[model samples]
Target: MEVAMRKKIRRIITILGTTAMIFTVTACGNRMDTMQPAASYVADFFDIPDTVTGIERLLLKDDMAYLCCLEEDGTSYLAAMDIDDGKFLKQNLDLDASVSLLDFGFAPDNSNWAVCLEKAGGYSLRKFDNSGSQVQSVDLAGVMDSPVISAVGRDLFLSIDMEGNICVAAKGGNTLVYLFDNNGRFLFSLDYEGNLMTTTTTAEGKIGICATSSDRMNYDLLTVDMETQDWSKDKICLGATAGLYGGVNKDFYRFDSSVLYGYAAGAQEGIPVFNWSDMGLGTSEVQLGECTDGRFVVLTASSNQTEVLSYEMAVLTEGVDERELLSMVSLTATPGLVQAVSDFNKTNDRYKVELTEYFPYAQNVSNEEWDNAILNLNTRIISGDMPDILDMSNLSVQIYQSKGLLEDLYPYMENDPEIRTEDYFENVFEAISLDGKLPYLTDGVAISTMLAGADVVDGNNGWTIQDLEKVLDTYGANSINNLSGASFLKIMLQTDGSFIDWNLGKCSFDSPEFVKMLEFAGKIQESSQDGCGGTEMSDTYAEAYEEVLSV
Candidate 1:
């Protein structure tokens, strides 16, 4: 098989040309003024145990921190720690590796807590006493249908009312919420349509759920009576920019860029609880829980490559020489960027970078939502409220550059003593440069190439549209490779230098060459049914290419 593959690759290299593409980390040259630094609202940082490799859920009640922790060996357990002394109180009730924990929370009476886990059969509701001892385990396989269980979504919520009644809500094709008595007996179920936004249990033991409306513009707050199995819903407008963070006992927290607001049941107005800027935290992946004494506990995770390296817990009091705030915006708050901002804030006393994620929950958003977010960002830029830095990975650089919104970094690079053009890859700078101006600076570059055999192209290193057509005609439609039209177009666009004339600030997409390429791509896509082009080269193929390149 290896020898056959090598022969096929060598034949193909005769027809295609090598293409190199670069991906970059872009940063603008905008800095805000520095302000006087004062103490932050963070009371203290608590040290967590080394045994706790990851924290899935963190809850605070009665000055105790309850965490559903995972170990290095993939086993998980419930842990409790004293907030004041940062001492471990209990670390018991271990779960098997096969059981996947969905959510965990405390009972309203504070007597015990429970973790909702999903296993092979279905869901398991395991109750634990305050001392972290296993009290009761309820298997919910018989209650919910297999189809519903299989299609269960990640927006699951487990809430315990004042009477110790358990409510398990899973959002899938339909939002199905189940209620169980203290003894684990199934009580009632509430089936609703639309996506689940947030869930909360009121002080009166009523379970409240906020779900999206059919129009997707408003929210429907559904409050269920656990005792009577009756429910009522009210439609509320949460604005275009407001996002439901989470819900506590009686209040559901919604946030924008800076402020987190709390809304009570059936109330359209929200009260400002706290501002993220005042907390001195950079990332928005914060977990906020209210304590019994009216204080709030904030949990933030220090992560690397999406893995939790450590967890930091701080207390948010009732309320900074305000550090000069450098606002940075991105669609998603990547783990590396979050870690860098946290480190910068820790070391710098004058200025702090505040990351504002327009779509923090990017995984669950729709295309319309993305468009709306981009529109909002464009509006902000037009209004002169633009952020100091913009992560342009998902944005169009050409439009920004054409509109004169981006500043050229060439002057800054020339003036800075630390920046030397000789130390970096000069070709990359030239490739991305627009009319001798560098609009942004990148930390790295990536290369992508496509190899063609010299024999197919008359031993020429490069070929034009006519040459590609002749080769295609000779080899038949499926000869080049079984790449889809879209995939082929993307590669061609990246490699074609004539398509975009950066010097003239124009594009030749409507040219005859581009049209011909599109026609060829369409023909190839239609001829290949499976679209299995072996687009990615294997390790053996790469090794062979290295040998071929050396010649």
Candidate 2:
């Protein structure tokens, strides 16, 4: 029996906005060249690496950073990197010869061709196996590199080019986005959109965010699909637009729950905290009255007894109930090359609770019980009444993705191909099997790993403010989402956007317009600029053009 080549590469497409480019693939005898790893490649610029011999191009991918090398048999292989420890792992593929590529990308699972590259040479596409071997082939003539490749899913690629852009040659291809290349050339684009997005640029492939603008613009955010060249318009507000003085988009002044929050590193006494994300103009429990990066002052009614807490949109990764990752490092011991890992991670706390479990109720349950139990189960799951892990032997827990319950475990799988490729037994790893003969039961439960809280957390009983001081006072340690020090993330916690319906992916941020109502109370803080906001900001008259007249 012949051994199958590993890491097979099928097609490679080059994508980018180029000054000029060309794709020229010629059919000649394979140019047998030894492949070695190049020290480095352009992260964004066209810079080359130094001091390397065994690979053609170095590929830095989303799941794993890898170096491309050639096997003795002429197939390509990728040397993987361990992000936690920063070590190189060499993965090889089986092939006879005749595979050369300029650009490529490793998918989340370290598998090849989660994307296609737009190259300057003939159809610059490369496909590889898990072991880093070429498994497939696609040849096209006169290709250019002005292309964008986005693979938010498996086996699908969205590639956009400046030109000779990716044209849908076959049927079932017309349904994609298209665009004109830079310098006024028409090109085809494709649809491959996802709720979440990220980009990359490399010889294995590259992606960039490009836009055109005028001196005076009305709407500024333009989203161009690299694969389709299709575009969408957005106002592009980085959350709250609190003018220049401490807004969400700005650095220090972060808004949370429409309240302006700040840290006082300089003040000799105490500090005041407010929902910085909401930067209202007044002094209220839910409003940000007076705050500063270095000075915070809290003002409250003498009648109030309860202290208001900085509310979080969701339970944080470091909440009281969340598990913490233990550190294994030692101070006195001579540090070994190998690093020890701890399981007690306390940071997996960012959860809307209900939204994650509700969507899968139908998929994991059978049709006989799908409808009847789905709603109840979803409600139970979101309500936090369910166990951390669910028994799915008789239950069918399909990996429903439309809702944000699942984390596209693809990235984790890409980092560990062998772990995700095999059948998941009971949601647990096959190698880490629990019982016998139960592939379904062998899988790891989502609840077991995630610190999923009770669903009631997202309900209308959101947050109640009794005393205004807990949230606004400079002394309060637990800000929204359990922030201790000055944190930008606290702002993400302070909005109606923070509370979400896990089942439907519904969030409260831009909702029932009550969020604006909450904002109504908040504008009191930012707009004040008075003594109430803080002593520093207390009505200070700027020196007029004619200062002598003031005397």
Candidate 3:
């Protein structure tokens, strides 16, 4: 509030943690100077909850994270955690029969979870609530006919061989498909994964599933329509490999509005395992910073330690490492909610939504609400009203500049480079060359950012950390304005920057692990390429460990 109070609080914080000492010095008409703070300014973090156990996967909705974990006594449990506070709110459970959890079924309200019993040699998929109350289940004895089980909306779906069947049953252990309404009343089965299960709706209303089959590949690429289910093939695998249909043909890294993204893997060479796009479905995909979607996409690489893909603008599109991004939302729920699916779906279309409902990233809001927002925006746009949601990313800002939404900084920079350098916008600023002229206007990525994330000032090629560090020190040290000195320090301290850059489209490989594997693979490559005219293929490789006989 007051200057003295602010200074006192800053001093106390410095004593507690690493606080940068910021000294302001003003010169007449020359420029302002700020003394660099030696320490970093990491936000004071609060204590997190300790009750969580076996939280292997979490799907955050609004502020709640629907979590699944193996409990203390070797039982599977689904619980809700408050993301902000890390508080364990509640859990939903159905049958506690087997010791292993196979899958969690999808419904409008909550979900159904499947537990497999090997002794029985099959699974009994049950609808359970957050409290572990069982609402319904399939009898394992007879369910052997169709072992594969998946949930679409409120209906239970089963796949025997290549075909899909719908199942619904009351509070009993029985195997059935195509239940009448939400009750266990058997209506009919389909020759394929339920007809409604595929091509049933858009990315909104009905869920769409695409399942393609391949006899060669060990796994399949099961495309879950972000909406409901449009279509799904039985043996489809991602990053395409040859199969029954001609050959794998699709861009491994592609994104459209309806499709949003697709991967036809069998494209390109040396870049076979190239991680790309934000909506990736791989285990190694990096977190592309954090999203409002609650779950963060880990960046296989980062620049300036702040935003992802912070390297200079180039044709080489930085790829995101898609590890945590492949998460499914609302894994499990109470069986009562599953049991009540019939009335709920019929009662209100609003209640029937996708698995990840209302998540911030791919938020599943009511079409009515979404349409209302869109319409309101249109009305405002036509009526000369300002924008409501204004979070346009760095790339979007470039477009905004073209549209004349940004202020031209040419005069300011030209008048006084010393004074102008003090107030750089958020994130990295990309300087655009105007008609092959001198340093012109620049576009900022954030309120403030490092120069490494920005374009090259010297040679104008390659993202060199040395150049970046130098520019940041200049900006961070000399500017009276807020300098993102903390970003550089944080990245250096918290991460392996060299490894990060390798993954950030610099090294031209998936990761250092992949690179090391390739280097190791070079030794074996000679032997493996005997068919490729290697002449003499070496079959041996260096090993760090040798397990000898027991002495």
Say which candidate scores most in TM-score.
Answer: 1
**Candidates, ranked, lDDT:** 1, 3, 2
303-411, model 3: which lDDT tens digit per residue? 1233322211011122322222111111111111221221232234232311121112212234455446545533543454333112221112233333333344445
> What TM-score should be assigned to candidate 1?
0.68
Better of 2 and 3 by lDDT: 3
* Residue 49 lDDT in candidate 2: 24
Of 1 and 3, the candidate ahead on lDDT is 1
Predictions in order: lDDT: 0.60, 0.26, 0.29
Worst 10 residues of 1 by lDDT: 5-14
Cα-based TM-score, every candidate: 0.68, 0.21, 0.29
Off by over 4 Å in 2: 1-64, 67-77, 93-102, 107-110, 114-121, 140-187, 190-229, 235-551
lDDT accuracy of residue 451 in candidate 1? 42
Q: How far is candidate 3 from the true structure (C-alpha RMSD, Å)?
A: 23.0
